[model samples]
Target: MLEHWSSSEVDPSIRLDYWRDVAHNWVDVQPLSPGDALEASWSLLRGENCFFGTKRSTAYEMRTSPRHVPPGEDMVVISLLEAGEMRLNAAPGEHQHATAGMLGLYAPRQEACYHWGEGARQTYVALPRSVVLAALGREPGNLLLTPQRCALAPALAAQLAHLGLLARQPGRVSAVEYAGLLDATRALALLTLRNLGRQGEAADLPDLEENLHAGRHAAALRFMEQHAHRQGLDAAVIARGAGCSRTRLYEAFAAQGQTVMGALRELRLQRARAFVEHSPRLHVGALSWRCGFADPSDFSKLFRARFGLSPTEWHRRVWMEPALRRGA
Candidate 1:
């Protein structure tokens, strides 16, 4: 069932106090903007595995402390910005900005403040920290991600938005359907992290023994993708990050007809191609270095072998063809 509260529904004289009390029931929040015209609304739905909600309000900052946090609530809040802008102070002197199409991950027991600009609208999912950690294989400290930066982020955001819509129509969903939605949500979250190259941190898996080998292989791949920008990244480093023996890591890749270094090279080349396609102003030498190639000659040779053209040629063709078509 969804529960909703709006400051407009309350008497004018007590709106401030009423809004504070309502916000306190969910999380530790403090209103930074004050006036009789304070307009805000919050709607939330509780599920067996998570809580989904949408909030719209004026400017406010979050205050999370032992005294302010609700007792027995251990959750990681995943928030997506729908409108306006938000500034997150994850730690002293550390600030990050989140705008529309961006998602923020807030860990449990972490001290962070969220500042929203005027007329901010945000949708969030609150799930147990244990569940999130299990899915991610590690704790991903407060992170702000732009969906456009990763291939899987857009799908994840769409899934979350759909879940929010379902939450609002509780009567239309069955218990079994809700459980399926939760499973899909968790899987999408994990896929997003993996695609962003942020997964693969060592995690304790008490019941995943049967899938350990496959898990290790997947972790190694993600680790390589995440660190492909480092010139010194290699097979041994990938094995160490995946917490597996070098020989086993090699066998894992061989199963897919690939070698560890071969996979890393391909990933780097793919990134270089993406950069060339998206950034027309970047020079070939700079692009090669940014993609972790120590020598531009080697980069040029590899680019030609992979894409049938040198980096410069590919860039010019991709960027110029569009303009030529438009001119015609």
Candidate 2:
């Protein structure tokens, strides 16, 4: 489920107060520049394995105290800034600056202060520290995962952005798919951290490139699965969503002996088959439209070619199996 909060719904005079109250569990929000005229929105999907979300706000400052955090919560926040600028300071003379496309790993248990410019937009995910430890065999330190620091950081950032997209369309994700995403995210993050820790001294760089492509492939699959219901969904959109170029996306799919449109058609057919199996009385035309087919006849033709029977025949077969066996 996605939870959303915005200062727009509150009275102008009390918007800041409301945001501060609403966000008290994590940090104390303050209007830093363009004072008191607060405009910010936060949306989060708190999954069983991880929390993924996005935040959009005007210029603001956030301070976290030790008391604000739970006594023993062991989790890390990974943020990818999409727009504007940010300054994060966790201790004296320990300041990190970020701009668009920069990824940062943050320790929530530590007291910290964050300041960002107007129109700041970011996507983030929070996962248990154990996930990192299990993959990296050590606790992750707070630092920016930039291209200069880690070659795999861009791919990991792309995965985080993909999670943000999936969070926006929660209905498209199943428990199994969500678990798959969590696993991919954990793997990518840990690989990035491992690479970052090595500081460009790794003896085996091919492994990192392989994992980057794998991460991109998994991200593209999730994006396609979520947007398959749209008739216009194609390779370009898939490439953008997966944070790779059209050539790279094609190469990834081709490496597995798959085509982008073929995979999309398969996804649509699978969904249509599920509906036909369950909704016995639903109309074929409506089902076809729901599954992104522009023409019912075309849908039927493809369905028959794939399943060796038309949807109606498949439906009949599904419902008649038990009765036919009983008669036998």
Candidate 3:
């Protein structure tokens, strides 16, 4: 679902209070120019493990503190400036300016302040701290990257904009598809961090060969997860997409106590389960083919084996069991 909040509809006198309430839900913020005519619009797209959104507003100064962060919700926000500029204070005596086509990283539980220029427009992605660290292999302090310094900045900005576009069209995406998109987005972010040399520990980093192997392995997994629904998808295809040899791909999965085909099957099953849970009305046969299962009977058998029930039975349990229990 896409949620929108704007101050244009509220009374002029109460606009500040209304905007404060809306901003407080995401972070601690106080409008610096409360007396001025304030206008803002926020569009949010929520997912299972991450969110992408956009904010367009007039000039304001905002701050985030430990007291404002929600309990147990550690998030890092990657912001891309589409227009105007922002003066950011991520730490004491440290400041940076994020202008158009630039990116900024905001860490969790860190106190930061931003002074947004008039008509500032920014797009952002918020993911859990664990996700960000897992992708980057290091803690990301507040960092800023420019297109001139980082070759991947333009690509990263494009991906962020694409995510925002996807968020706006909710009717065209399913839960499983959205998860695939998120996986792709994460892979791009990891690539961007690598290209920027921001993964940290250049001196103590592993040998080049080892690091390259690890990166290729992660890339293969991400590719398989994103394209699991494609027919005839296998290790060879994954290897080609990940820029590695088929043997190297097999070795990578073998190190994890699994095979390439095994991982592909698992990804397919995960997608099937997501569809079953979120789209209960979808027919089992259609869902089977949608998830890349060649045969409906085979899909049903595997679904039963993995989930302890046939597809129809599982759907009924998920959708109907609660109502029956409530009646009791």
Best by lDDT: 2
Compared with the true structure, all predictions reach lDDT values of: 0.71, 0.75, 0.73
Better of 1 and 2 by lDDT: 2
lDDT, candidate 1, residue 231? 84
TM-score, every prediction: 0.52, 0.52, 0.53
What is candidate 2's lDDT per residue for 152-190, written digit by digit as tens?
A: 888989998887777666577876776677767766776
Backbone clash tally for model 3?
A: 0
In the range 77-115, model 3's lDDT, one tens digit per residue, is 888888898877522122366777778777846777877
Q: In model 2, where do residues sit more than 4 Å from their true spots?
A: 17-24, 33-35, 90-94, 133-139, 166-183, 198-328
lDDT of 1: 0.71
Clashes of each: 0, 0, 0
Encode model 1's per-residue lDDT on 48-142: one tens digit a residue: 77877777787776755445556667777777888888867622122366777777777746666767767788877777777777765667567
C-alpha lDDT of residue 237 in model 1:
88
Clash-forming residue pairs, model 1: none
The best candidate by TM-score is 3
- The superposed Cα distance between candidate 3 and the true structure at residue 263, in angstroms, equals 56
Looking at candidate 1, what is the lDDT of residue 71?
65
